[model samples]
Target: MIQPIFVYGQHILEQPCTDIQLESPQLQNLVNNLWDTMRNAQGCGLSAPQIGLPYNVFVIDSQNAFQAIGKGFRKRYFDAEDKGIQGIFINPQLLEVSSKMWKAEEGCLSLPSLIKGVSRPWQIKISYYNEQLEYRIQEFSGLTARMILHELDHTNGILLINHMGLLIKKYLYFKLKSIKKGRVKVSYPISTR
Candidate 1:
């Protein structure tokens, strides 16, 4: 069964995730649940903290979504399709990021009723272990890059609202209140209206 995702302003999203050791069955279960939650929500990615689990675990299905977005860095290192965009990332460490930035609208499974415009690095090189505990280095650019950065932020207990300007932060506070009061459902594109 898919677990209930924690909503916006939850304390779990503010706490850093613990690193996952490859040999642990607990890590495996977290990976499985994250994937299931992402697919169930039609989300391109998910982090363990979104489900009230504080572990450095996330899953991404970048290939299909990348194709859907119509553009991506073509010097491919991993099979966009075969990678299934559904692999587990454990103890992820973003080694480097490009100076360039890209603005995109981001949504979270945890904050299912909201979306927001945020800027993130346009490219990044990340190192992480797979479910089997094998180390892998992956380079991502454009949309995939943004998704990875967003999930990484979740692992570190950061939220898109935290990156927004002060005015935007104020707007989000009220918007979040409205959400809690059942005044809205699924704030599309950007929630800070």
Candidate 2:
């Protein structure tokens, strides 16, 4: 079932999420809901906190974002093996990050109509459990790494706005206020509590 995303200003969005038990009965359902809600909202990634759940989980399907770009674009930044990854990350940890950095504009499901430039490591080493409850440590780079870092921030109670400088936040003050007031417009469902 598709769940309504909890928008910015919701207290849950600010609180850090808790780790999930591998044996939790509702784990599968939660992962499914994350995927369903993300796809419904046409977002490449969705975190458990986005749906009012405080579990340390997130789902990503970078293929959808890749499909939107042209072949030339893909060839420039991606390798032949970079078809994209689709999976659920549970109890994830950012093991390491490369010194190299990349900056890009990112929009979040919890912050509709807001896009901001954020800088993140160009590559990252992460340890996480898949939906099957299998643990794995892997390295990711390019757009995949960017998406992972964005969702990871959610699990840590961090928002894209936190990356903004004082000036940018001042400029977006009213817009953020509107979102917190539940006045922003979006195609998918949203909850402000």
User: Highest TM-score, which number?
Assistant: 2
Q: Which ten residues in a row have the lowest lDDT in candidate 1?
A: 184-193
Whole-model lDDT, model 1: 0.73
Compared to the true structure, candidate 2 yields what TM-score?
0.96
Model 2: which ten-residue window has the lowest total lDDT? Answer: 75-84
The clash count of every prediction, one per candidate, is: 2, 0
lDDT of each: 0.73, 0.89
RMSD of each: 5.0, 1.2
Error of 2 at 106 (Å): 0.6
Residues 1-193 of candidate 2: C-alpha lDDT, one tens digit per residue: 9999998888888889999999999899999999999999999999999999999999998777678789888764455778778978999999999998877789999999888877888789999998778999999888888999999999989998888899998998999999998898889989986
The TM-scores, one per candidate, come to 0.82, 0.96
Clashing pairs in 1: 60-85, 61-85
Residue 59 lDDT, candidate 1, scale 0-100: 84
Report the lDDT tens digits of candidate 1 across residue range 89-166.
788899999998766678776565567878777778999998778899988776677778889999999976677788
